[model samples]
Each structure stands twice: as C-alpha cells, then as structure tokens.
Target: MHKSYVGRRRKNPARIEMQEGNETPTRDQIESVVSLYNGGELDAAHAATTELIEKFPAASILHNIRGAVNARKGNHEGAAKDFQNAIDTNPAFPDAYNNLGVALKKLGRQQEAIENYRRAVSIKPDYAEAYFNMANALRDLGRQEDAVSNYKQTLRIAPKHNGARNNLGVLLNKLQRYEEAVSQFSAVLLANPNFADAYNNLGLALKNIGREEEALASFAKATEVKPDYAEAHYNKGSYLFDLGRRQEAEASYAEALRLKPDFAEAFRSLGAVKRYEKDDPQIPYIKSLLDRNDISDNDRMHLNYALGKVSEDLGQHREAFTHYQNANFLRKKFLNYTPDLERRLFRMVRESFEDVERIKNIYRAPAEPFRKTPIFVVGMPRSGTSLTEHILASHSQIYGAGELTTFGMAVNSVWSGGEVTAEQLQTIREKYLADMNRRDVAEPFITDKMHLNYRWIGFICMALPGAKIVHIKRRSIASCWSIFKYYFSDFGNGYAYDLDDLGEYYASYMDLMKFWEERFPGAIYNFSYESLTENQEEETRKLLDYLGLDLEQSCIDFHETKRAVATISSMQVRRKLYKGSSEEWRKYENFLKPLIARLGED
Candidate 1:
C-alpha cells in the first residue's frame, strides 16, 4: 500500500450517457425526455425512456436513457439490466459497456464488471470517459497499476479532467508518492474549489509527509464545505485521536457514524473507544443497534459481525459462531451469482498461486527504486496476522494500514492481463512499484497483512531484493478448524463444502511456507501464533527490534488504540491481549478430530 489517501480515486466521477436523436418517429418524445433528465426530473425521464422503448423497441438510445434514469434513482440492478439490454441491442456501443460496468460494480459483480469496463475502453480507445470508468473498476478489482495508467490516459486525453486528475492523485498517494499526490490534489482544488473530498484527501497526503498543521487546515475546509462527508470527519477524528484530542475526536467520530450508520468501520472505532474506556460516552452501541430489526440489511450484516465479537468476548462461542456465520452469509449475498461462480473463483485464486516462479514474474524491478520493504504477515486467514499487525502497529513508527492488497494487486496486474513475458513482467513491476510509491510507506516499512500474500512471498522477494517476509505461523489444526467455523465472506474456501479441501489447502500452504524458508533463508520471520499468545510483549518487542526500531510503550498497549479494524478479529483485538484464543480449537476438537488425522496429525 502507498499511504492512507492513496490507491483509491476521487468518488464516482463517470456519468451515464443519455442520447436523443433529432430524426426519428419519437424525436419530440426523446427531446422532451432529455429536457426532463437535464432538469433533474428523473421520474419523468424514466417514464419517457420506458414509453420510447415501447414505441421503438429496437432503440439502444432509449435503453441507455432508461439505464441512466435507473442509476440516478439508486436502482443499480435495474440500471445494470437496462444497460445490458442496451448492450445486447447494440453490441458495439461503447457507452453502454461503460455504463453497464459501473452499474455492475455498484451491484458487487466485480470480475464481470471490470471485464465490461475493459471492453468499453478497448472498443473506444479515445473515449476518455470510458477510460475513467475503467480506471475506477480496475481500482476496485484491486488492479491498481492498470487503474493508474487508465487515470493517466483520461488526463492525457483531457488534461482539465479534474476527476481523473484527482483519481491519479489518490493512486499516487497509494504509490507512496506523497508530494506528487499532494500536487495532484492541489491541482484539482485549483480547477474546482468545492471538491471537498479532494481537500480531505489532500490533507491525508499532507499528514503522511508530516505536514500536520496544513493537513488539519485541509481537513477542516473539507468538513466546512461538506459537513455530511463521513470520510472527512473520520480523517479529522483520526488526526485528533493521534493528538489526544479525545472530546473533539469523539464528536467527529459520532458525527461520522450519524451520517453513515452502516459503516462497519465507525462502529468498530466506537467499539475500540469502549474497549479503552476512552473519555467518550460508549454504550452497548452496536449490540443495542442489533436489537432493532428496523435497520438496513447492510447495517444488519455489520452488526452480526460486530456481535460475534461481543459474544466471543463474553465467552459465548455458540452465539459468536452464529453471528459470524450470518455475517459471512450476508456479505456474500451482495454478490448475485449462481453456485458455479464459487468454483470458478476457487480455480482462479488457486491457479494464480500454482506456479510460484510464474507468480514471481509479477513483481516490478525494485533493486534500485524500492530498497526498504514492509513486514508481510502471511498465514491462514485466522492464523493471527491481525493480532500480529495490531502488535506491530502498536509500535510508534509503524502505522498499520490494515490487511491491504497492494503487493498482490501489483502482482496480479501482471498475470491478470493474461500470461506475459520478461518485458511485460518488468513493465508491470515498475508500474506497480510506481503505484506502491503513491500509497506511501515507500521507505522503511508498512504491514500488508493480505494473508494470501504468503503464497507470493518467494516471488515478491525475487522481484524486490530488500523485501521482508514475516511468516505468521499457527498450529495446523488450530488454524484450519478456526477458519472452518467462523466462515469468510470475501474469498472462496471459507464456505468449502468438504473437509478434504480445507485439509489439503492447509497442507499446501504449510508446504509452501517450508519450501520458501528452505530456499531463501532469513527471508521469512516465523512467529508461532501460540508462542506469540503466550509472550506477546517479548515477541512483539523482538519483532519490532528486528525491523530496527525502538518499541514504544504504546505498541505494547495496542488494544488501547481506537482505530477501525475491518478483520473478523476487530472486536477481539480491541480488548486487552488474552490467552483464551489459543484454546479456541479445543471447543471444536471433537468436530475436527478427523480433519486432524487428514493433516496426518497423530
């Protein structure tokens, strides 16, 4: 990851097209609909689009208009269907492809969504707007380098494209090119003064470079311009939290949550406040919210995840498992797919990691540019990477960016575009390094706890000579069984139907780790999960010192920090370090005994 304000673009810049033909049977009707849409009469536009389609069923233009209207009205599924209808009606229509991609992305069909976006640009090379949409989709698909190039492409074609420029600024920030990101954000402000998000993000880039006072001013202007902006408020609150401005930070965090209640992060932040008994009014906020069924589905899903924490903390494993399972269910429900998609995704991730050396080809040249590297905490999902991150993040110098996919994204960008050569690999590696520089943490360190990064560690080190790998180790049974019960929402295998896959996957991961350690001695830091649980302080101190940094008292008390953690262990990590987690597998020992035998654990 580059830095706090990097890797993402300015919010939702691309707009769907609404066409009106001067010569047609429904020419007057089309003009009237266009007038209504231009005047923000979305309902009237929708009706007209429907009527026009009824009268002229072959018109892609009418379908596109309907899709735009549906999109504006927050009917993304409807908008996506209409856009797809437009595409089906006119297969070569680039605008429809772009709009369909945006709608599909909003609807959480990311892979297909990105493919549509890519097709849009391919069909219309000079369509800067299509490139902008493509860039956004690429960023979401975790293909940051391509997004960077596309953002640049939009700006190259249209320099005054404030949106693309702003997005480039964000990507630069992720690339760890703070000065460049700042300049880009400043450039957006120059072009359009009321871009509140740009100012807020500018402040992030500024704060990253240690420009505290200037960062504060930018954040304040962002909030002043858009008081309801949750991110701006959150940014200011984070700054205040750092400065120990407890009351001010609490108010800001509260305001942020007030505006975006479905934000799992704000709730997690509030939970952290409660954990520390920070000078903030902390109720059973998340729990109390869950008691009400009137809340939105998004809120319910997050509540279930948070509830798992409370249950776990209260020694309610059964309740914890149920809520986590529900959370896992709900997060996946956002993706509208048949049963086949899961199998496809499994193959996709598996196949990518199959050839270790081929995967190595994804890393850009870092021999000269990227000397200092981050601590890569790689292990199974529940194998204590979060805990390791939290422990290490407790250090005064190393701020936890939290489970980022910067390295994987950069690597994936290489193969994701399909199998490549020596030249393509080198080009992508440089492009991604440039992207990484935008995220910040270009120098000494950053924690990219993308646990899956474990599979790519060998390839990563080969690409970037100075790269450091921390192999977070956990007992085989403990890791596998923990994953089986809690369930994961994002990737496949968390809901794997068979025990054989889980066991084999576990064995494969361990074997991979062993091979890497043997091949590249001193490249991996093997920290046993059980050992760390027994001696967090000593081990954490050792880990920090190994990175050549002095440990702060604060690092030892990482639980006291009030930051938003997005992992399954967010709730657990907020509380003081405890030993019970080490005993977690015991509860399900009877259930996992056969699985243990599969691991050949006699």
Candidate 2:
C-alpha cells in the first residue's frame, strides 16, 4: 500500500552548530524554540522565536521557525514576510525556499510560490515534496500539462506518492484521456482500496468510455466505502437518471440531500427526476434557501432554476419566466460573451463557405477510403435533434452516439493554421472514427447529433463526402424561447442567457445553414420538427429511407427504445410524440418580443 505523507515542519538537528558571533543565540536556545513550534504551542513558540531572533539577528533558521508559527496562527502575510526574510538571510537554504513557497501559496501568490518551488527543487534535486507543491501551484494557474509533468516527476522520486497519482488521474480525465485516467485511478485503488475519491473518479472515466455497468459498480463501491459521501451519491443519481432508472435515481439524489442538506446540485437533480406539483414541499424549501444571504451565488442560481422548473410545471408561466430570467442573469454575469463578437464569427463562417466554387476548387479527396457513413444531425438547440436521433437509433444498424464534439474538435485542429491538405483531412476522419470506436459504436450507420455541428457542415462535407447530414428545423421563435427557458451549463452556448442574444444567434444560425445549403447542394436532408411531430409515421419512414434502411416498426415506436440520454430532452424523448411543445412559445409571447424582433418574426 502507498503510504500517505502528511506535511509538517521539520528541524535539522545537525544544523544546530553554534556561530562565531557572541550575540548569536546558543544552539540549545534555537532547538527549544523549534520544539515549541513543532509541538503546537503557537503563542509560546511565537514569543520565544521573536526574543531569540533579536539575539540571533542573522539566523535564517529562526526566521523560518517564526514563519511556520505565524502560518499556524492564520497570519499568512506575516508568515510570507518572515519566510522571505529567512531566504534573504540564507540564500542557499533549500528548506527556507520551500517553506517560503508554502507561505506564498497560502497567500494566493501562486506564481511567486511556483518560482520559489522551482528554486527549492533546483537546490535539492531529489525534493519530491517541492515538485508536488509546484505541480499544485501550476494546476491553480491552469497550466495542466506542466502540472502533469511535475506530478509524474514527483512519483518518479517517491513511487508511493498516492496524492500525486490521484491528481494525475484528475488531470488526465480533464484532458479527455479516459483510458489513462482509469489506469491512474486504478493504481490508487490497488494501493488503497478504501480511497472513496479514487472510486468516484474511476466511475466518471468508465462512464465516459461507455462502460455503463462498470461505472455504476464503481459509484456503488464509492458509496459503500463512504456512506455519507454526498458527491458520490449525486454522481450515482446522475448516471441512474441517464440510464432511465428514475425511481432509483430519485432515491440516490434524496440520500445525497439527506447527508448534505444544502447540496444545491442534488436538489436540482431531484427536481428534474420528478415534476413538482403546486404545493410541493421541496419548492418552498428551495425558496427559503434563496432568501438566505449566506448561500453562494452558484447555489442561488441552481435554486432559481429549480423554482422555475416547478413553476412551469404548475402552469405559472409568468412566474416561471421571471425565475428563469433571474437565474440566467446571474449566470451570464460571470460568462465572457458578446453578441457582436458572435455575429462577426457567424459572418466569417458564411463568408468562408458561401463561395461554392471556391470551396470545391480548394477541396481535395483523401487517398484513404471513408468507410463509415456518419449521419450528422445539426441545428439550433432545442430544435428536436434528440428526438430525431432517438427515432433513427431505433433502427437495428443505426447507433446513436449522442452529441459528439469530436468532428468540431478535429476541424479546429486541422484548420487552426491554413488550408487543410488531403492527408490532414484523412487524419481527422481517422480521429473521429477512433473516438466513435471508443464509445463502443459498432453499427454500419451512426448518428452524431451534436447540434453545434451546424457551423462545420462545409468542413464535414469537404472531409467526408459520403456522410449524410440531417438539418432539423424548428420555428425560430419556438427554438429561441426554448433556449431562453433552460440553463445551458456549457459556456460555449452563452448566447442563450439573454432574449436579444438568443434571437440574434438564431438568425445567424439560419444564415449559416443557408450558406451550407447553397455551398453543398443535395448533401443535406432538412427535417422540420413541427412537421415531424404532426406526421411521425411519414417523417420516420422518410428518415429511414434516407439512411437506406428498411421501414422498421421500432422507428415509429421510438419512445420504447432504452438508452442513456444526457440532455434536457432526456425525459421528453422517452415519451410518445406530442404536439403541445410545438406552440409553447405563444404562452410568453410578450416576454419574447425581443427574440421575435431579432429573428425577424415581428
């Protein structure tokens, strides 16, 4: 088992030799002060260190000891000054440098701490603790790659460093290297089976890779190891909800709330699992929390959204809209979004792809054969992309890999410099296929319903001419209003936060889709959401025929298809087709005038 290393102040007994100056404190006096500090006698230690520092005015050891005492007393600034003084007194003392880094990190001077940590490691090449500390500071600065490298170096020096190993797993998970993350987390479990966090992290990695059963087992293991682990319970609930086990998911979420009464995320998840009636007790509880000044901004945002959902369920449309608006306002204040900037981006996209002849002239076919035929479903958010995917996934040979960002990421990678070559396009295709394979896709035709793929249609056609594109169209007002009603957690869709921005974005989306239609004629199959909802059988048949598949009864009975859905429409897609959602925008038409005006519906 890997041993845990608790950081503590250490005094070098061999460094207690007397100096030549008569005014210098005796080695015995310094040793007594160090013992007082290490023994948790902070007040007595501080007094003794101050008196000794006067006698031994040039002793770096005294300053470092005083800094440790100050840090214990929660005086970070004072501790930092004392540590800096120690370093100035003895420039070659590696311990003083490392201690100064610790003090600076506590003061939130991460960049300065990193520099001191670097100095400490340079002075003592085998300083694993210094390397670990430096890695944490780098992570705080969002230099994840550098942090990963430093963590690896720490493990090399101290192979039993479980903390470094666990942190490395977290970084790998953030980088989307799920397989490597699983391995790192598994190593931590092998060393200590009782590590609940490792189990939780392993579950997330497993879930990302489509190992649903294994992921559930990991989450269950985490909860078993720590019964009161609120986060683990919440994660388990999320997975269960995605898997369509609503009752079990509700239990998990409720348990999380019982353990941590103020757990906002768990409350939100519970609200989503089951709709609340007009007099539901949870609604009032959430409202009371909103009245408190002690709750964090993030919690307040969640509570407001929860209240909005409940109000909407109770048919209080005006109250619901107000709550949704307030919630989005709070969230948007922290996001970096500019409607004009997004407008310029849309213009750039149209300009880049509007010239069909220019695009064809520059396009080159890859030498490798594009074997897989990806059916990409792209459109504005809340435009029935999930419903379309659910219907098509009912076909035996059509796998629904929901909302893939791989193609968008690949396009960004290839086009970051200049024109993409045929070989580069082939590499992008291979990368996309590799990602699909990672998701356990094995069917001949698969649906990639990443709605934002609308922006990359030209690139999609250029890279894979054999791919089929399905553009789901909804009424602009309905789409924009639906976007406004929900809180999109992804900052990439920040335009949804405001009515005017939502309207402008919808307009830009239509313009780009028009450009794609003109640029790649006959390549896209435009499907209307309202038309499909009104004519399910006819539309389902048309969609299956487009994919070259036989008319299967399951396609029309798509509501019965069991699969993991991770979108807001997860519940909606599981129900039979209905027409009520088509005209929902009419209820809040007055509040939606700004969006209507921007979408040119006025």
Candidate 3:
C-alpha cells in the first residue's frame, strides 16, 4: 500500500508539495482549476474556487489560483485583490506575493510591485521567481542598475534562467554596455537555444561594436529560429540599409510589415528608404492611425512626424514643418520630455565684450607653423556642421572626414585619466591624424567633423596647435525644436525630451562658448547655419580661403559630388542648395512663444 501511494505521489508533484506545505485544498484542486481556466471553462474555475473558499474561508491556495485566472481574463484589479487576499491569509506564501507583484506591475505600479517582490524574497530567501519579478519591477521603475543586480542574483541561484539572462542583456544594451550585453544574450541562446529576441539583440550589440559580419550571422540565426519574427526581419533590413543594399533592405522591411501590420518602426524605415525622392507608401497608413483612439498620443505624435517627412519629401516644406512642430509639441507632454546635456554653443557679441581682455592675452596671429593643416568642424547636431564640412570637403586639396569619433575619444582618454605625458599626447595626435587617412582618400588637408568636439576645443588645440575649429551655430528655438522632433537611438540627446531642459542646455552651450573664446582665441570659428544658407557663395569662398585652398568648380558643384553621406541629412545634401527651410520656425510661433520669450529676454 505504501509503495503504491509513493508511485501515485511521484506522478503528481504539485499535490505532494502542497500536501507537505499543509496548504488547504489539494494541488489537484488548483491544477483542475488551471486546466478549466485555460480550456475556456473560466466560469467553472471561478465557481470551483468560490466553493473551496467558502468551505475553507482562509484558503490562500484557492485565492492564488483564482487570481491567476482573473489575470488571464484581463481583470487586473480583480487579480490584484485576490492575490492580496492570498497574501493576507498566508503572509508567508512567497508565490502569491510574486503573483500579486506581477499583477500590480502590469498596471504600471512599479514602486508598489517592487515592495511586494521585496517581501516575497524576504519570506523565502531562495525565491528565484520573486527575484526575477523584483528585477522586472526595478526595470519598469527605470532603475536599471538595480534591476541588473536582481537579475544577476536570480541567475546565480538558477544558472539556466534564460528569461532573466535575456532581460539582463536588454538592459545592459540600453545602458550602452554592448560587449557585456552580447555575452549575456549569447549565454541565453546557449541555455534556451531558441530565443529570437535574444538573437536579434545580440546582433544589434555586435553591430554597435563594429562586428558587422557576426551581427548579421546572429540576425540570420534569429530568422532561422523563428521565421515569423518581424523584429528579426526589421533588424536584417536596417542592417542591409546601412550596408547600402537597397533592394534587399526594402524587401526585408516589407516582409516585417507583412508579418506585423502595425510595426511602426518598419514604417519609419520605409519612409527613410523612400525619402530620396519621397516615394512614401506608409503616409496613408500613418494618417489613418493618427486619429486612432486605441493608440497613444505619443504614437500619434510620431505618426504626425512621419507624415511630415512624407510631405517634406514630396516638396511640401510648409506642411512638413507644421507636422514636425505638432510632433514636437505632442512629444513634450511626456514625462521625460528632455534632460540636460553639456554641449557648448556660441553667442558672439556678449562673448566678445566679456572675453575682450582674455582674447588679447590668448590671441596671436598664426606664424604659418605647419605647411599642412586640417580644419576641424565642431558644433551641435543639425547646426550646419555637415554643410560646413561638405563645403570644405569640396575644396581641391581637402578631404572630408565626416563625423570622426577620434578627437572625442582622445579627449575622453585625457579627461577620464586626468593626466597625459607629452609622448602620450603626441601619440594621440598622430592617431587623430591617422584617422583622417581613410582608404585612398589622402589629401593635404582634412575636415575632422566631430560635432560634439566643441566641448573639447581646448584639448583639441593643445593636441594639434595648427588645427582650425568651426563652431556651427543655429538659432536656439530652431535647434532645440529640431532635436526634440528627431528620434534618437542613443543617450547623447536627452534634451530631446523636455522644453525646459532644451533651454537649460542652450544656456550651458552659451556659457561654454564664452569660456572657450576667452581661453583659446582664434582657435574656434563660428558659422551659424542660418547665415551660411543665406550667403552660401560668400561663406563658401571665405571658409575655403581661410583653409588656404584656392577656389575650384568642385566647391560650387558640391551637391553633384557622389560622396557617401552617413548623416540623416544625407539625401538632402545630394541636391542643389536651396533656402526652402529658411523660416521653418515662423509657422510654430504660437508653440514657441514661451521658448521665444525665454531666448529673447536672455
């Protein structure tokens, strides 16, 4: 009889575990309820659980099972209440607490869910499930570092925790720890062997670090693992797009949208693909989605922005500007509107007055110290840096090194280390120059267009004493508005989130420019984007003459050059120079009233 009972118990682990724990209602009772709930007999499960609860009023197990069923039916508040009842009846039931936390987290109560997770972990120190739930709560709260620690702890207790590992990788990637993230995602594949999202993310991480081939292999593997994975198709398309494989890229984008009709990212990519001549097919869909009550305001805002791009491409500049303005306005209503960044901007007139004496001390005419020179274009994004670069790049003897990360890397090494020997500095300077030596593009002079290099102008001058810097400037409202409307994949432009933050950043830029002008006179040149577009020929000639490059027809036919452009303005630069967008901010006068007041008063 004992042996028969033992065999029967081995066949039902949940029953034995529940019996051992002395919980009311059998494990069989809960399993029966779960089966009914999953098999569309949810009403039966509710009736069974209610009867069990009446027989044993403090039956936490019945309450927990009922809560899971309620969660399935989208009754989040009901599930939360039932889970709370379970915890209240049996305070030591860790699984019930975890379930309650999940329900609360689904409702976006991150802080409260975290408290429940903490309680579950406290009651059951080895509760790996609770740890995972805690990590999720922390991630929802935007406390990513804390979430990572919790996730790592879960995996430490259960090495085969694929879900935890994959989530950890996603968080690390968002934090820009690409290599570390790659390792975690790879480990998840090793454990689960079929995680498509993990494989897709691994590809992105590898690509970010310049391992393009391996990234492509990972993405291919993701599609192989799950042919229906729209994200993998999108990933493949974006990669192909970057590689300049137009046909294959478009096909991939189309495939992704076919698999998932509401894939907005895919729509954005389609718009980008057709942007050269404005062959957009996604605008109609976006327009239809713009008035969707089911979608978010934020989604609608991005849709408007997409419609704006379509109009902009179709030569409807005014309509495009209006849509972009609306998008920026709608996006501002979000909580993370914008954050502060430490980029420098130039304000010349007051800077001249304040730095009059300092400039007198620092200013000295160049003695023609070096026959060879490289001009550095330093400024904010969309601040005429690219235009300045294209003009110089068109020069007969100058090469355009578009957006070189070298100078910033060197300066970061200096700042992060806080000390550098003369030999070290010389090595860095050589690296900077060697960076300009691209494949078959040798020239007497090159343009180092590290836009953010404006902050490190002092270090830049110290390293290359003969280098000339062009600080590209744009109007404050226009620049901030442009940034806000631009969606970013990285963290550098946090000011895109908020109007106040944009204003604060503009103020910071002004201060830095003032400091640099005082500290390094004649080291930086200012070229406002507005002014440059207004007087293109004169500015082009003046800029080229400064670099000692003689005038050439190539400079005039800059738009005709078929050079590779990686910036978002790549397609726009391929056309003739025009002043179509000279007064883009005028239409948004009502929207910018506050911003204008702020800038005007200052």
RMSD of each: 7.3, 5.0, 10.3
Q: Model 3: clashing residue pairs?
A: 337-497, 337-498, 338-497, 338-498, 345-509
TM-scores, all models, native as reference: 0.64, 0.85, 0.67
Q: Which of the numbered candidates is closest to the native, going by highest lDDT? A: 2
Tens digits of per-residue lDDT for model 2, 1-602 = 00112222233211122233345567788778878876879899999999988877788888888888888888888888887887788787787788788888887899999999999889999988888889988987878879999999999999878888888887777666788989988998899898888888888777767789998999899889998888888888887777778899899889989999888767766877888887788888888889999988878877888888888889898999998898888778767578877776666666665555665676665656544568999998899999899888888988887877689778766665444456656667778877766654567788898899888887788777778899999988888888887777665788998877777777778878887888788899999999998988998888778878888899889889988776778778888999868689898888877677777885
User: Mind giving the per-residue lDDT tens digits that candidate 1 earns over 406-469?
Assistant: 6666665566433435564565457546655556453356677778887666456666566567
lDDT of 3 at 416: 41
lDDT per residue, candidate 3, 153-174, as tens digits? Answer: 9988888877788888877766
User: By descending TM-score, how would the candidates be arranged?
Assistant: 2, 3, 1
Q: Which of 2 and 3 is the better model by TM-score?
A: 2
Give the worst 10-residue stretch by lDDT in candidate 2. 1-10
Per-residue lDDT value at 348 in model 2: 65
- CA lDDT, every prediction? 0.70, 0.80, 0.69
Better of 1 and 2 by TM-score: 2
List the candidate 1 regions with Cα displacement exceeding 4 Å: 1-131, 137-144, 157-160, 168-180, 203-220, 234-252, 259-265, 275-296, 332-377, 380-410, 413-451, 460-468, 476-505, 518-525, 529-581, 584-602
Clashes of 1: 24
| lDDT value, candidate 1, whole model | 0.70
